[model samples]
Target: MYTLAVCAEMVFRDRPVPERAERIHEAGFEVEIWGWTRHDLDALARTPAHFSSMTGYIRGTLTDEDGAAELLRTAEQSVRAAEQLSCPRLNLHGTGLDDKGLPVVPVAGEADGPNWIAAHRTLTRIAELGESAGVVFTLENLNTAVDHPGVPFARAADTLALVAAVDRPGLRMNLDLYHAQIGEGNLIELVRRAHGLGLIGEIQIADVPGRCEPGTGEISYPAIARVLADLGYDGTVAMEAWASGDDDLALERFRSAFTL
Candidate 1:
């Protein structure tokens, strides 16, 4: 069965930070955090929770202006966070585009530029930095049409292409199923493809139609989990879903859904 890590930002929004960590272990799951601050880090230190992964915005897009430099800076900062928090991976977004598919951080008024080249250069540098520091960089695709509209690189195929181009052992893609179901179908095939190529670094689960816990929407998470298990996917598959009922109940339901 796939392992589960709870996104503190999504389900534990109302709880205190330290208690959030405790609640995750209480429910028998690892903890995943977002946008952590000094207070959050200090509070996290006192907990016995295992931080599986961390994700947030970096200064630049993967293909926008100052993209490579900003990604490098974020990589440097991520290593420090990883060392302290014990989370070895940093998942981040690409330089976003507009509705018409242009860069959010344009260079001289240009939006769309050479996609593969920019991704290769930016990710390669970040990979080099992270490789030495015992951290890894992951590129995640989000649904722009739904919850995360307007961001480019919101497709599983796009991330696959980036991983092929970058060709770094320390660089990979985060297959977020909720967003992929919204923006790209063929979830099982995509997972198979990524697994075959060794490009999937992590997996995030939530049902489509709504970013709530599994079984609340059209997606069948049991089938998805079985597919991963059949393929020998031993990586972390975190539940980044929002809570629709009691948080404990929701966590229990999620754990059961992904149970092998």
Candidate 2:
């Protein structure tokens, strides 16, 4: 059976992050967070919630010299924070995102050959860092059409290719289906391909259009859940969505969708 979790940053808007984590733990699910630098790690550590993953770097881009150096520097810091929370996985992106979730350095189109080479070298160093730190680093896929435009390697296929090229145990794909559905269809096949390669570290979900809990929009999460089960994907499937209604009810809906 796959483990279930919720992104505390998206839900429980009324409480502090630690309090939200506690609430999620009490509600029978693990917790996920965004940037660790914004929260009190001591307070979060006191809570009983088991962390799934957190942002791996504070500031850096994957395809530049200065940005890659900053990325590695902050990644080491993130690894220490993960140790404080006992988080096993740290999430990364193609580049640093600003407060508004836009890329700090936006690319005009697909990454060129030089960009790809630089990104691979940076991720290879990141993999070494993860191996030394004893934590896995996941590269997440984002949709350029809607949420994160101008971000290089934002597509699931791009992320998969990068991770596979590195072919390191310390690096894996975050595999966000919400972005995949927006950027590319054929969700089932994507899941199969990623899982078949044994390169997925975690799976994130949200309904299309509204970005809310399951059953509130178009994606058939239950069917995807069944596919995951069929593939014996004994990993984490986290709800990185907002509550369309009450938070508890939204969590229940999320659980129900993946209950198989």
Candidate 3:
């Protein structure tokens, strides 16, 4: 069976982050968070919840010189924070996102050859940092049409290519299905391709159209669950979605979709 997790940052909006994490843990799910710099790490550490993953950097981009330096610097800080919570995986994006989820430094169109080369070099350095820090870093795919526009390397295929090129134990793909459903509809095939390449570090999910928990939207998560089972992907499957109505019900629906 796949290990299940929920993004505490999305649910229990009325409570503190630590309390939300505790609630998710009490419901038999591990927790995921974004931007550790915004939360009280000491308080989160006190909770019994096991952290699945957190944002790997506060500010940086994958394809620029100064941004690459910033990414590596904050990634090191993120690693230390991960240690406090015993989190084994740290998540990354192509660039830093603002409060509204827009990329801070948007790339207007497809990245050029130089951009790809620079991104690969930056990721290679990130892999080296992860190796020294005893943690794994995951590059997550995002949908450019909806939540994040103009973010370079936002596609699952792009993320998979970058990670595979690095081809190191310390670097892997986050492989978010919700974004894949929006950006590239062939979900099963994408999973197969990423898994076949041995590049998946973790998998995140949410139903499209509303970014709500499974069963609230068009995606048949149970089918995906079966596929993962067949693929023998015994890794973390995290729900990074909002509660459609009741948070508990949403979590139950998420669990049911993947229970198989």
Candidate 4:
């Protein structure tokens, strides 16, 4: 069976980071670390559990030499943080526009331009960094139609394409179900295809339209869980969703729905 990881960032909003992390860990689910600072690290040291994944941006385009250099520094910091925490993977976002309208793809481009080669070079460098620290760098798919509009690599296919281009064993895809459902339906087939190619490093789940618990929306998580089991993916299935009433009740139903 796959392990369940909860996104404690959105949940446990009223509690301290360490307490929230411990709460999720106590619930028999893995915690996905939101931020790793000196304080968070100190807090995590006392917890009974560890994190399954970490997600954040490098804050610049890989297409530019300076931006890529800055990204390398950021990647190194992230890798060191992951190493210290014993978290094996650091999640990254694919290239696209920044808030300043810069071409968030690497190396060279006009604002909003797609620079595949530069992006590839940048990810490869980060993968090398991850390899040195015994960590994997995962690129996540996003929903351009709503949540992450204007990002060049928002679809499952887009993320897979970049992964192939990067051609690094230390780099893979975070197959985000909610984003795939929004960008292009047929998520089960997509997951199967990604798993077959050994491209999936993590699987993030939340219901479409509402981004809530599984049963509150149209997504058939039971069906998704069956595919995952058939594929023999005994990994973490992260519940990155919002709870409606009680978080405990929502989590219970999520486990029941996705129980393999």
Candidate 1, which segments miss by more than 4 Å at Cα?
96-113
Which ten-residue region of model 4 has the weakest summed lDDT? 102-111
In terms of lDDT, the poorest run of 10 residues in model 2 is: 209-218
lDDT of 3 by residue, 1-260 (tens): 68999999999999999999999999999999999999999999999999999999999999889999999999999999999999999999999999899999998989999999999999999999999889999999999999999899999999999999999999999999999999999999999999999899999999988999999889999999999999999999999999999999999999999988
Per-model root-mean-square deviation over C-alphas: 3.4, 0.5, 0.6, 3.3
All candidates in order of lDDT, best leading: 2, 3, 4, 1
User: For residues 50-112, what per-residue lDDT tens digits would candidate 2 score against the true structure?
Assistant: 999999999999998999999999999999999999999999999999998899999998999
3 versus 4: better TM-score goes to: 3
When summed lDDT is taken over every stretch of 10 residues in candidate 1, the lowest stretch is: 102-111
Task: Count backbone clashes in candidate 4.
Answer: 6
Maximum-lDDT candidate: 2
- Give the TM-score ranking, best first: 2, 3, 1, 4
Across residues 21-125, which tens digit of lDDT does each residue of candidate 1 receive?
Answer: 888977888888865543368679778888888753345677645766775776677678777888878887666444343446544322254865776777887
lDDT of each: 0.77, 0.97, 0.95, 0.77
Per-residue alpha-carbon lDDT of candidate 4 for residues 1-260, written as tens digits (9 for 90 to 100): 78899888757778887888888888888888644542467667678777888853445556678877777777777777776667877887765345443335532212243567777888888878777777788888877667765565667887888887877888989888988999899999999898888888899999877888889888999999998999899777999888877888778888888886
